[model samples]
Target: MAEHPAYPVGLRLTGRRVVVLGGGQVAQRRLPALIAAGADVLLVSPEATPSVEAMADAGEITWARRRYADGDLADAWYALIATSDPEANAAASAEAERHRVWCVRSDDADAATAWTPATGHSEGVTIAVLTTHAKGRDPRHTAAVRDAVVEGLRDGTLVAPHHRTRTPGVALVGGGPGDPDLITVRGRRLLAEADVVIADRLGPRDLLAELPPHVEVIDAAKIPYGRYMAQEAINNALIEHAKQGKSVVRLKGGDPYVFGRGMEELQALAEAGIPCTVVPGVSSSVSVPGAAGIPVTHRGVAHEFTVVSGHVAPDDERSLVDWPALARLTGTLVILMGVDKIGKIAETLVAHGKSPDTPVALVQEGTTAAQRRVDATLATVAEAVRTHEVRPPAVIVVGEVVTVGPREPE
Candidate 1:
């Protein structure tokens, strides 16, 4: 007997009754997607995985807290027979057959009426791949194919230029702590669709090389106290490209809001009536220290962590940070863009009653191959930076938390 090819169709399970006959790993994995589709799921099981229990507790699903019984599939538009008991699974399958409800069996796929596909979503498109023939069923192969297609679409390798509609706007994407892989999925997707990308030198630089040659890459690197692009110029570039119906991406380092001047760019776009999207990134404040095996806050070590910009000297009239108050707090302090002014900042902290022997760590180019950690104290950090030639774009950690992690190679 030859198995015929299965017809593929998306089930609109919204507000529909769905009966699941297991609360184990299989149900835990499948329940979220079902719930997301607005399915009124009822699970019949003696016990469930902690995650499944959490879902039930959250009122996302109805849990029977018992084994499957007859008439469980009476009004179910769909059913999943995945109970540990083979007899229970067989009975549920038979009930589903009698009721003409499509059911998927985790144990015996051949006996099931439905097959779940390897699914993924990119942009606004849902990708689903299923092996149709019973003899040729290969879940791993189907998943691999799905992943390849999804990755291609996400990285802009698979182009549907003619069929795809272009939206002209600016996307402020956070590239995330200098790691190319750390960028958010939404940020990466927007980059794939970008016509003009204004990039920073501090973030995921490797991704720039992966962009198609057609994309105009503009260097908007704001090198600290060095050669850099002006903020006004960057704002103008974003406006100009967007006004020309180009999808412009302002790719920045770390979170756009976390000292990235993202609001300035947004304000400029708003003034010009250009639509903008801001995708948050992993901030270097916490991630950089973590990358160096240092936790920003540790139990019984530091109760609070503060992130401050050190671009301005504490004595400068334009400085907004209250150095004296920060010094008084017995917690971790993370300073960014403070390499040049670290000596002055450290002096101010010590003068304000902070211990001069407070442990300090300078994580330069954090989360990248060029990353290096320099250890010191408030008294020695100024010298450590000078001796080590530690540059800007580094995160400086001050307090006992810096001593909590494994020692960096001397």
Candidate 2:
């Protein structure tokens, strides 16, 4: 091992060029920030998930749909290898070393020079939690503990350095779920540095308390049944802020890409030549139900699961989902935005093969302190919701999984 010298305290990646050599979730999670930090990111991987592919398709990031080569690192200021294969990541790490540029290996195994510390961002001010999670122990567990400590600290600390220096153009955020406390450590840091926050309406307002008292807030949400600002407008605003050299937060509800339009907005920023990054949030569709005493999947109840949207047109029969196939699948189905269409949806399910007696539940504002849940069967769900006057911002769990809930403590 070689001795590593201390580098500058604030050598950020803004306006630099970074090469990311992977296409799955890790790169997807990190790519936005690289762009947000004003880095011209070039992605080199054999495959890309839908979101990553979309970013590439939109030309937000340069794409090389092949394995990493020595020259792939050319003109690169930093390199990140996020491939599932450890060997490829090691190779990329080696290439970065030869180039004497910074590198972060997502695998974080042997031979990598640097690690992606637990970090958070809001605006351009970032707070990073550095820990010696050095090998052998669980990385995720260490991150969780670190984040707990970071969250407890108020936002006032970032002010001294922030006012003296230009805000770094990178933010590493952690998007908490409906419960604000679930946020990661680094997520807390970035929120403290933010000058403005463009957040989802559901991202636990209490969590925003960490921001400095004067931070600007914008509610650009597309919550079901509730009015929402158009996505184009939100993207334009984020880009404009960054172009004005202002740090901004594109805060999102869940992991941002779990049907949160994160990719769309991110692409818009890249196309507009604005900088960006992403902090993952726990998805409420699953976490919410689990927290509400309803298991969306269970042994014998359901062995398979699929999450689909209920926001489609009412009678666009041709574009509607295959009701018969879904009914025959014998698994759990989680429908987002299905509160208003329960009766017809249930009828469609039964008309195919789902039994009219199948168990169902409507979970509203799940995982929040204000959560409410009502249980019934396919035959009774429509009436149950109507009688209770349940609104949107709800998730419907179908199949026998809804039958497994708290037993009143015996």
Candidate of highest TM-score = 1
The Cα RMSD in angstroms, rounded to one decimal, for candidate 1 relative to the true structure is: 3.4
What are the RMSDs of all candidates, in order?
3.4, 12.8
Regions of candidate 1 where Cα sits further than 4 Å from its true position: 40-74, 144-164, 221-229
Worst 10 residues of 1 by lDDT: 221-230
Question: CA lDDT of 88 in candidate 1?
Answer: 92
lDDT per residue as tens, model 1, 1-410: 22697778999999999999989999998999999999999999999999999999999999999988899899999998888899999999999999999999999888889999999987778999998787878899999999998887775567546356767899999999998888887788778778999998776889898888899998885423234358877888889889999999999999999999999999999999999999999999999999999999999999999999999999999999999999999999999999999999999999999999999999999999889999999999999999999998899999999989797786
lDDT of 2: 0.72
* 272-377: candidate 2 lDDT, tens digit per residue: 8766777777777788778777777787777888887777634556546766688788888888878888888888888888899998878888777777888889
Candidate 2 error regions (>4 Å): 1-176, 221-229, 317-320, 407-410
Q: Give me the displacement of residue 375 in model 1, in angstroms.
A: 1.7
Colliding residue pairs in candidate 1:
none
